[model samples]
Target: MPDTSSRIARPRLIEIIAALATGGLLTLMVLSNSMMAAHTTPLFSSLTAHGVGSVVAGIALWGVWLLRRGQAEPIAKRHIPLWAYLGGISGALTVIITSSTANSALALTGTLALGLAGQVVLALIFDVFGAMGIERRLPRKNDLIALAAIIAGTILIIFARGAS
Candidate 1:
């Protein structure tokens, strides 16, 4: 039956987590930029550390969320989305380190490789959800569009960063 009941609930949850993740990253970016502009070394360093720390902490937090939610609601044919979030953190770290080493060809190539790898991981989540036929029931035109845009933006980020 594709769990008609879950279509509403699961989408809501997926939207919520995605929003929170996006908002958290945006807020961190803004705060970090503001602090750097103000020349507040300690605050900038602390905020940067906090942002990185939050991602590491998210691995545990999301695993718990998945465990709790999966008991009643299974999305993407028993595949867990929490792992994707962890990969995202690792991907960002790879990009940061590589971008910093712009002179090194290995670093530049590695940055693109990591970013694409993370996107593929995310795509796998969507693909599984699709194969499960959950998305078919949702009819989420707006959500799909947003997903496409985000993926495109991510690709652009990888390209732009690589060239810089």
Candidate 2:
């Protein structure tokens, strides 16, 4: 086995914490969206979520701008590719799809498990091909092992849920 001394170094620990926090927040978001979808439609739930997110993001950006108004260095301007703007569309679709699945027999647990599996697969592909300006890197042995474990767990969770 590789040396494990640095496994939880400060930076890595911070990343782990951040990932955990994000996952918790995501679960809450999915639950809220699915509940709304149950009463309203999936499309409506997605639209409402996105609308609120946009307003919140806009306010955050405005606050950041105000805080940095007197900075000496100018903010660098980079041309954002059209594809970069498509994330909102993807987010909307994700909400709609997850909402529908969460309300089905799959429920939140199965839906999250499958979604995580899909995300891992796509992330691996993206990393290999350097999609969306990400650094191109081949999966290491540990990476593959982790991916396998995640996929196996996802399959077990999904099937177990279905069998119940």
Candidate 3:
């Protein structure tokens, strides 16, 4: 039998914590930005795209936590470099800068959509070909299809909101 302990390590735990914290912070930033946007002309809606993302990321976190607690007690998550986290923060800052300078609602929603798409893609890729302390947690093909469908649905919802 394979030595399971060797596969899991401390760095992975740190990544999980960092990812969770980052996701939460992004959610807060977007909602607060939405309120700020409300002061502008029809630029703000009650439902910000980041709110949806908060749920998605939260679910991802829950799944990871469950896996660690139950099936893989000692499983450490992948450790991402400081740069990766900074990259996301930079993207958010870019959105802020753009929104401040010009007609930014369009760009903001598009950026948010793109960000969500990236998460979906990363999760799916990780599920299909496990990486970064995350294992292929789903065993069935249907799970993959379901995840894809959800991402598609989320995109449609955001687009529909923007249309109105």
Candidate 4:
């Protein structure tokens, strides 16, 4: 029989790509926010950056959607939930908060540490609650352990002033 492993591997490959893209985005945010803050106030910089970025990203996504229109399933805007559309509001707030907080005594690493810690906790809450159409997944002992480790590490990083 012919091997059909490629189909089985496709999801994992897509997950890997998504992870890489997310990581890249986080890194870019760190660098850009830091640099932008240098020229003006953090809040102002963040607003400008996010405004420009949103426009560029919107255009890029639209272009990509247009190009791939025939190859993939058409997305139904009506089927998307109202909650899903509100994510941009949260994202805009994130840019403001993260930019204003980062590099303001906390520094990049410390800011990122605390941010990641908060993100994990919130994500766990969302997962457990099955919020926003996600499937419910209760946290286990291992999840607690991981969260503890992450919190501990973040605390350590925040306090370790001499290391940076």
Candidate 5:
């Protein structure tokens, strides 16, 4: 039988908090970009918002890295790759496309759903291929089932938006 814990450890609690925080931040980012796009060109809004966000996040990370200088170990060479450094480019593309989509017929829910579905599919492929230096973890049957459901839901949301 598996043992059940009465309380969470600090590291586990931190992980939970980080996960929730990421979700909250992403929600806010989508809403913010959409709102901004409503007032200006999607490309301009994406550029401005993503630019500021990148600078702020970079500065914050720099500060943290400075403070942690001897306390934390550096990333191992095996885990680092040129492609891994292209996350900023990916973020830029994501912001541009999301802003444009959010301003189009898809609106918020449809755009987000479709984007998430695409991401889930790509993530599964990446995991299976061990792309970008990640350890390979083959997708299970449940993953494929979940992806199908997500795609179906996205299609429903998009068509429902059109019908309304």
Candidate 6:
């Protein structure tokens, strides 16, 4: 087998841009969710967000279906485990937690920084364990270093905000 440890795939320019854009969108989403939570409640906020998202997704899917009416082959249905549906629960929890934290001393920046750190740690665990059918791979030295740096930054931001 090839030495894949040192052969990390470099992200393309477009991929990098897309990632940045997604980050921006996430920040906006968190902000909006938190605001809704502030006025109403976390549960209400999550419900509203998901309801809107479902409608938008349904419309988009309908448009795609109309555009590709007979051009696309029928997709084969695969068995999806019931556990896969847990993502909706996880998403609701995320909104609740972030909404609560963002309204607290953590604020938006601290919330996002800590959230990023959590994501890095979970991603490492998922990669190592091949969770949810993800490819199993040992984290590279650089990955650990990056994780450490992100954690350190998150801690600093959280503490700095608290100190002010």
CA lDDT of every candidate: 0.61, 0.78, 0.63, 0.72, 0.73, 0.79
For this target, which candidate reaches the highest TM-score against the unseen true structure? 2
Clashing residue pairs, backbone N/CA/C < 3 A, model 1: none
Cα error of candidate 5 at position 101, Å? 7.0
Off by over 4 Å in 2: 1-11, 73-78, 95-117
Order the candidates by lDDT, highest first — what do you get?
Answer: 6, 2, 5, 4, 3, 1
Against the true structure, whose lDDT is highest? 6
TM-score of each candidate?
Answer: 0.34, 0.76, 0.42, 0.64, 0.64, 0.74
Residues 1-164, candidate 2, lDDT per residue (tens digit)? 54422222223678879987997998899789879978998888888888898899999999999998988886776677999989878876786688779889988777878787789878877767677755566777776886798678768866787678
In angstroms, the error of model 6 at 87 is 1.1
Question: Model 1: per-residue lDDT, tens digit, 28-93?
Answer: 875765566357543445456667778989998998998798476644555556665475566456
RMSD values, in order shown: 9.4, 6.1, 11.4, 6.8, 7.2, 4.0
Candidate 5: stretches off by over 4 Å:
1-24, 69-76, 94-121
lDDT of 2 at 130: 70
Select the stronger candidate by TM-score from 5 and 6.
6
lDDT, candidate 2, at 163 = 70
Candidates 3 and 4, the one with greater lDDT? 4
The residue ranges of model 4 lying beyond 4 angstroms of the native Cα positions read 1-21, 71-78, 95-118, 162-164
Candidate 1, superposed: residue stretches over 4 Å from native: 1-113, 122-145
Worst 10 residues of 6 by lDDT: 2-11
Clashes of 5: 0
Q: Give per-residue CA lDDT, model 5, range 1-164, as digits (tens).
A: 33322222233578879987997898898688768877887787788887897899999999999998888686675545677777878877877677668778888667767777788878877767676545666656765686688578767866787667
